[model samples]
Target: MTLAVLLLVSSALPAQAASNRAKQRKLTDTQTLFTKAMRWGEFEQAWSVVDPKARESRGLTGLELSRYKQVEVTGYSEIGSMSEPDDIVVRVIEMRVVNRNTMAERTLRVRERWRWDEADGQWWLQDGLPDLWQGQ
Candidate 1:
């Protein structure tokens, strides 16, 4: 009985590890796509990467998108990331933004919160959107 149990447990480990690797790959791909969208000023396209719950609650608006048009993302880089409980990943992103009208530039750090949605089999950004004009 002991040997049989051990055999079953050992057989499951590799499958579990493969699943983890796949999830990690998906996360990396999603992050890359999101970063590119932001850098290129594709706010609408970027919105698709946000969590559905966030979208439903915050709801992207025309005024909000207009604000993005007022500024251009000059640079975007991920400073660091950490994994949290409940399959959550938090990342610190540094962005160099320039005001289109004034041509003034500013560096801002934004914290991005991502959570793994089991039903969807993917990760989602819990934070609705980056408020680039928050204190401007």
Candidate 2:
């Protein structure tokens, strides 16, 4: 019984590690895609990457997105991330934007919540950008 239990446990370890690795890979891929779209000023592409539910409710008229659309993003940096329940991760991103009419340069800190959607078999942005126009 002892040997049988040990064998079973040993076999399960590799399976568990593989599952974790897979999840990590998916997260990395999602992050890369998000970073690329955001840094390039592809707001629509970024919107496409957001979770369907969030996108539906927070469409073009959403405060978060509307605020972003009002400015021209020059650059961005991924500063921090925190894991959340339900396979979600919140990321703190800093963006450099130039005012559309005034051309004033400012740095904005935005928070994006990302969630892994099992049904879709990938990660999705759960929340829209925070008040990126603050302190501007």
Candidate 3:
């Protein structure tokens, strides 16, 4: 009975590990799409990856989204990332932007928080859109 239990447990381990890898790949792909959209000033596409609840809470108006167009994303780099407890991941991204109106440039580090939603079967950006205007 002990050997049989051990065999079953050992068989399950590989499956669990593979599941984790698949989840990581999905997250990577989603992140890439979000990054690409942001880099190209496609806020609508990037907004699709954000957590629905977060979007709802923000009560974003059309003017709010139009603000993103005022700045051009010159560069975006992922500085670092850390996985926290409860299926949460935090990534630090350094973004360089130039204001279309003023031609002034600035670099800002944005913290992107992600959470795995089992019901949704995917990862969602917990942090809403980065406020490029914040502190400016």
Candidate 4:
């Protein structure tokens, strides 16, 4: 019985490890999509990643229209991430943005929430610009 129990535990360990890796990969993918949308000025693309409730609350259409203006994203760095069964919270350490004409770069630390929608088999932004580095 002891030998059988040990065998069962050994088999379970690999499955749990794989599950954790999958969750991490999903979180990374979600973060990548967000950065890509910002870099390309694809607000609609970004909006597509947002939860429906957040979309409505923030007037997604207006946000998309406003993003028609030119903007540049220099880089993104992941500060950390926390995982839930169906969601992930990521803290970005470095996000650099530049205005088209001003040629000035602004770097900020931002935190965002991403959700995994099992029904759609996709990950999406569930919240927005929750906090800035300097309270601005």
Clashes per model (N, Cα, C within 3 A)? 0, 0, 0, 0
- lDDT at position 89, candidate 4: 59
TM-scores across all candidates?
Answer: 0.96, 0.82, 0.96, 0.69
C-alpha displacement of 99 in model 4, angstroms? 2.2
In model 4, the clashing pairs are none
- Taking the tens digit of each residue's C-alpha lDDT, what string does model 1 give over 1-136? 9999999999999999999999989899988988999999998888998999999999999988999988899999999999999999999999999999999999999999989998999889899779897665
Instruction: Report model 1's TM-score to 2 decimal places.
Output: 0.96
lDDT of 4 by residue, 81-132 (tens): 6765545555545777776778777887776777777677667777753232
Better of 1 and 4 by TM-score: 1
Local error of candidate 3 at residue 1 (angstroms):
0.8
Residue-by-residue lDDT tens digits, candidate 3, 24-124:
99999999999999999999989999999998998567997888989899999999999999999999999999999999999999999999998888999
The sequence of per-residue lDDT tens digits that candidate 2 reaches over residues 1-136 is 9999999999999999998789879988887887787767677777777788876886766665666677777877889989988888888888888877788998978888888887878888877544555754
Ordered from best to worst TM-score, the candidate numbers read: 3, 1, 2, 4
Candidate 4 backbone overlaps, count: 0
Please identify model 4 stretches exceeding 4 Å from their true place: 67-70, 80-87, 116-122, 129-136
Candidate 3 regions exceeding 4 Å error are none
Error of 4 at 50 (Å): 2.0
Worst 10 residues of 2 by lDDT: 127-136
